[model samples]
Target: MAPASIPRRAALTARALAVGAVAVALAAGCVSSTESGGARLGQAQSWSSVAGGPPNSGRAHAAVSDSPGLVWSRSLGAPAIGVASSDGLGTFYQATVSERGCNLFALTADDGRKRWCLRLPTDGPRITATVDGRGSLFVPMYGGVGAVSAEGENRWFADTLGIPTTVTLLDNRHLLLISHLGIARVVNTQTGLDASSELPLAGEIPPADPGYGSPWCGSGERGCPAPGPAAVDTDSGTAYLTAWTPGAPAPELVAVRFSPGETGRLEVAWRTGLPEGRLGVPVVLSNDRGQVHVHSRDGSLHAYSTADGAPLWSTPVGYRPDTPPAVLPDGTLVSGGRTTTVWRGVDDDHSADAGPAPVVAVRPEDGRGREVWRRDDLRQLTNPAATEDGRVVVAVRSGGTDDEPGIAVHLLDGEDGGTVHEFDVPAARGPVSGLSVDDEGRIALTTAVGAVYLLG
Candidate 1:
């Protein structure tokens, strides 16, 4: 484990800055939006502190809220994939499994309390979950999509033709899901109608090669390829998905629009050839003046037009950006890695004239970004969450090794990149995921092993 390289500020010159500016202008005029919003989103509330002493081992995800308390914490077996939080409910949702089968849990925001647990019928090797505006949790199970109410009740389930990959909330009442076989489905969040008709694919699959023998296959057994993640726009009924074929050299990116129809329209928005290697899912920056940011394992950030899938700009990022980039309300793009860098706009136009280079403000103008302040001393993995009182809280641990395992809460000065306050929560072991904050300013963290901590 080598020290992550620090980006040289001097290297980011006039030319590169100009490119960023151009990218923003281009995105402003060309990017388009999709998705419809119906439900209200929640926010975080309180505080707590977990001290270092015991050795608890289990991977888990956490959620918090001040009005109610600490939400629930769920375990993700040995290796967890992802965790998501709902706006006002104080309920944290995560996808996990034990020997029985894949499970989705809805937990209370005040304590490590379980609200409702929904178990899948089949053995699902991979799973992902997200919440709609209406507070329903949509999870992608093995071969179908499972809808769970915020109160922990099972709503309904929709079967899919292929292995389910990703599930995302489209708006308050609509949801979108994609499968490994390149099938994208849109369902009415309230009724669970097969809104697939409202999408563009129209039951067409990307051509497959017989000789390729399922590029994702292995050892005489079918190895399900890691399906690309899906991103949605709550304001408009638009969805974006990316997929790569076994024989194809690059990942295929697709954009689709969803509305009130049976047969939706599908179009090959944009396709870019990627280098030979495993690629992460394409994350759509909904508030990003209409641009899709694709992060590659090779440490490259590629920007595409949300409207037509046109390639806009490509730049090198710090680490293999595992988490999605955080956008502030002021249109400042705050992406965290070895270090967090703030971009003023979305495109290739890099003009110094853009007013102070888009510092990480708490709010972004495009409603896509907020300003950010960074702590160069702390190493972080996921994006930091902002408190209602304007403090940006991040989850950090010892940068290089497992010996010094801990989580830190740094209060950032929203105006300038200044540190307002710092606190540390000791951990029993190393490698913790599922970090979140409650309304009262208490910090909740889940370790790699199955212990949950309430840190203030």
Candidate 2:
């Protein structure tokens, strides 16, 4: 099949998914050996998961780019429709949703070897894949979420809970998820089922206001944003998110306290209305320390206490960031904008809204930032993918042009924002999607078409 262009709508033709029956006995953050796989993948949490590390931090620890070589690349044979994840040790995973069906592949990151293929009862719109701390790869499908063990054994599966958001590995015992409907469910990784039929592992979102002028909380599958995906703190059993409450003037950041065990239910602990007269672009960012960060449409960043939705610091940047800032291991913020950092971009001005802007690393303390570095030539930058070893991966592309090369992936020193090296995208075009790292410090890019690139 030819590589696909950006898709219009993700349509899944699969039937009700089969969630394998796994007996549950959550004994100290471990699952029983029901899986056929001998042992888990690798202990190297190198670049596991889509966002990079366990909490999906989008940060890795390995020094991968210095020895630049296209170790290998694999063509999914179809356009990849969603973000990609890696076990980091070796196994890399992604989903291909097409007119036929949703195809999931577990490829060896070291050599692009096809280790296992897991197909689901769903096709594309947008699905996020994650690798459990223990090594199980999870894919959120239309009817249910699918889990495959490291050794290529089917572990468990469950339903199209609702408009699905990405999965978060909260802690050893529980897996957290939020549907488009704003309902939250906690899955027992060991049991693969809720504690009881009515254990109440669900939460509800605020009702939507029909009177709002703009379309509310839209995603790839359904644009209606009721309860968005959350930044969870497993220790406190708390979820921080934003929802467009009905009858309200705008969306508000909500802190929900959830019951941890099978008896989990949602409770709106507290919520703060987003400041009015901004773009209303609400994304939640969290670190292990319990601080929740969100970027407003206006040139400002807001920090809030995840405990009670208390305000922390509100620093004003000059430009509205297009995406949530990437948090480095040291807690510096990397955000995109026009002239907020020290290094001014040298790219000549054009009419594009995204011109030669600087990719800056800001110290979260005072909302002050310094130019980590900027490629004057590379205008529209992808979110910076950082590794714990002080290296950050950035994918850049020219704004508003398809004929030119799509995106160039670069490795930079997170400390000084120095360029380590750049990877070549063979036949690259269009903007790149899901620029992420795995446990091995290898960077992966899913093209607008169906190809997946693994560079280190």
Q: Top TM-score: which candidate number?
A: 2
What's the CA error at residue 159 for candidate 2, in Å? 3.0
Stretches of model 1 off by over 4 angstroms after superposition: 1-80, 101-103, 121-128, 197-226, 262-278, 286-288, 336-376, 386-391, 399-404, 413-417, 436-444, 454-456
303-419 in candidate 1: lDDT tens per residue?
667777776665544445333444433333344332111121233252211111111322333323222343445556444554444345555553334444454545554455466
Computed on alpha carbons, the lDDT of every model, listed in order, comes to: 0.43, 0.54
Model 1 quality (TM-score): 0.64
* Structural similarity to truth (TM-score) of each candidate: 0.64, 0.77
Candidate 2 lDDT by residue in tens digits, 326-420: 67777766664321111112332422234444566655554333444444454444446766776667767633354554556777777777677
Query: Residue 427 lDDT in model 2?
Result: 70
Candidate 2: where is the Cα deviation over 4 Å?
Answer: 1-15, 19-48, 53-56, 123-126, 151-155, 195-223, 226-228, 276-288, 316-322, 336-358, 366-377, 398-402
Q: Please report how far candidate 1 places residue 122 from its true position, in Å.
A: 8.1
**In candidate 1, how many Å is residue 317 off?**
2.7
State candidate 2's TM-score.
Answer: 0.77
